[model samples]
Target: MKPFLSIITATFNNEKTLEETINSILNQKYTDFEYIIVDGKSTDNTTAIIKKYEPIFKQKNISFKWISEIDTGIYNAWNKGLKIATGNWISFLGSDDVYLDNALDKYVKKIIEEKNADFVYSKVKLINNNKEVIYIVSDTWKWNQFKRYMKIAHVGAFHNRKYFDTYGIFDESYKISGDYELLLRAKSCLKTTFINEFTAEMKDGGVSNKNVFKAFKEVKKAKINTAGISTIVAFFDFYFSLFKYYLSTFVKKLIK
Candidate 1:
């Protein structure tokens, strides 16, 4: 009797926020999903937090799985989780992110209704480091727009098990844009559905935000390799995005 959904979190030294993430999962109104945590041998109290909640998950009869080890990066850790996920659909939630109480319920209902959809996504509330609301971010999946940039928020997005079986898992070479690369591999054939609801709260300052230039570079490469876009096109997209990122950062600093 496998679950319908599998939620995974790939974390490294995220002790400060991992507890809140776990609590959010525990509080999900829909409880049929399995949970998987992949730890990059965290040197902090992350494992301790996971252990503390192990019994609680068991008490609730929820399937809980975890692993801690040396890994190349976040993508590699996620690949590990993908190997063992037993659900029909899978999603990755950041260790510093939390789901809205009714998030899973909404996602499940939408998934059941959209039987042909292979990828499902919704908006995510972006919160700053202080846990203050910044904005909500997401978009309708348009192949043309996604070709230019990653338009949809991957946070809390559901990926059907068939997607992995058909297109394969995340490419470990990409440190930042692996998720984008994975989606790009499907090209125009990927079926997607969007729920006009905020499903999760994403805390700011993740690796992608902190390493903007490198992430953009990886995104360019992903576009070229997975989407078959011209290198020149990818090059311009990278520089344009880099400029925008710096401009936004500068503006934020000025406001502060």
Candidate 2:
């Protein structure tokens, strides 16, 4: 049987781009997947948008489940989706992100071809606020060097659901780097694969890029906890990342 994927999306007041995200999932060539959307009581047109698409999804016999309620944070909302998701494998999409055509079909093909990989990931195309392509980074990553940085993008990544019980859920306390923390914590236990094509297109202004210092702090803590590093070492990594983050952000602003 083809693998069933649970594509989870967490949204909050993202009326402008939610439509694109939802449409990307709905238009997938590979349809053996369920979409689990956890909304944080969006006080905008987000709920209306989801409601409008409900009948369409139902007509197609798609498993589309969503809930809008109060959540502590994005990762908390993600945990809710994870708890209710029933797919054999899972992937996440941001409210402002989109999957390229044939992303899931390629993912399924990868699964069939590479039987041992616990998770698979692909390349990502980053776009600025005006929808201009910024740069595409190589998705090829080594888990051993993860303590240096997150070489993978979440939107382009798929996870095997069976490992959730083994590694635990996203840390609700983490504001920006929860996914990184989860991946790092789960790295030693899971076998991962890197696909060769671009899977997702992402808008540049995610939480981590905007709040570099806070992200740095959370990532440092997560690295220390998961990698068994000394606080002193994590501290050095944090400051080094801090400098690089600010320098990159500054260069981008100058170019803009």
Candidate 3:
């Protein structure tokens, strides 16, 4: 029987936290899934970390495959994962992210119940480098909101493979906002539903957050090209999110 889900991760040199990411997937109580890892030829201990889990995956009867090679970027590595993924639904996870304790159990159940929905999204827990829960990002969003912001956290969103066959893979040119662009493209042709669950824990300071200027630039371009949101609206949303983040931090400091 084919796997019901595939969890794909694109990593460069995330040796420190990659183990937790892999272990979370392997420990899923819901067993009908495959895990794929795409590495970007990390010079660090990333590959060694992967090798360490090889026997564990086999002994546990988990279907797993991974490859480390030079790739253009995260989006390109994800595209490679898509090409080889054979799951009915595929979810993307970063090397520094981990699923909640019952993430797979909930997602698998939701997927089966909401079989017709093309996309599934859930809220996420954001943890800082200090391993503290800084925020929970599950602001309710309508499907029509994709034109403005990335309402769907890619770490907690699952895409039905059929959408990939129809709408296509992540645009490799975008280093930061390709996933958001893909969500925009899917809005036109897919049915979306949300599960009221906290699905994953995203370690803060991701690639997108680190490259703020470039991320916003690509998001603006994606909005204009993919979703047809005006440049003005896109710019507003970008700045609005920035302001919100800083304001929240400032407020936190005041409270402290």
State which candidate has the highest lDDT.
1
Give the per-residue lDDT digits (tens) of candidate 2, residues 97-116: 99999999999999877666
Candidate 3 on 1-256: residue-level lDDT in tens?
3338888999999988999999888877887777899999999999999999999988888778899999999999999998888888999998999998888878777778888777888889899898899878776657566578776667857888888888899998898889888878866565877778898999977443458767878888898888888778878877887778668768978999
Q: Residue 109 in candidate 2 has what lDDT?
A: 91
| Highest TM-score scorer | 1
Candidate 3: what lDDT? 0.84
TM-score of each: 0.96, 0.94, 0.90
- Report clash pairs, candidate 3: none
Error of 2 at 186 (Å): 3.4
Name the regions of candidate 1 deviating beyond 4 angstroms.
Answer: 1-3, 206-210
In model 3, what lDDT does residue 167 have?
Answer: 88
Ranking by TM-score, best first? 1, 2, 3
Clashing pairs in 2: none
Query: Whole-model Cα lDDT per candidate?
Result: 0.90, 0.85, 0.84
Off by over 4 Å in 3: 1-3, 206-210, 238-256
Candidate 2 Cα outliers beyond 4 Å, as residue runs: 187-189, 206-210, 253-256
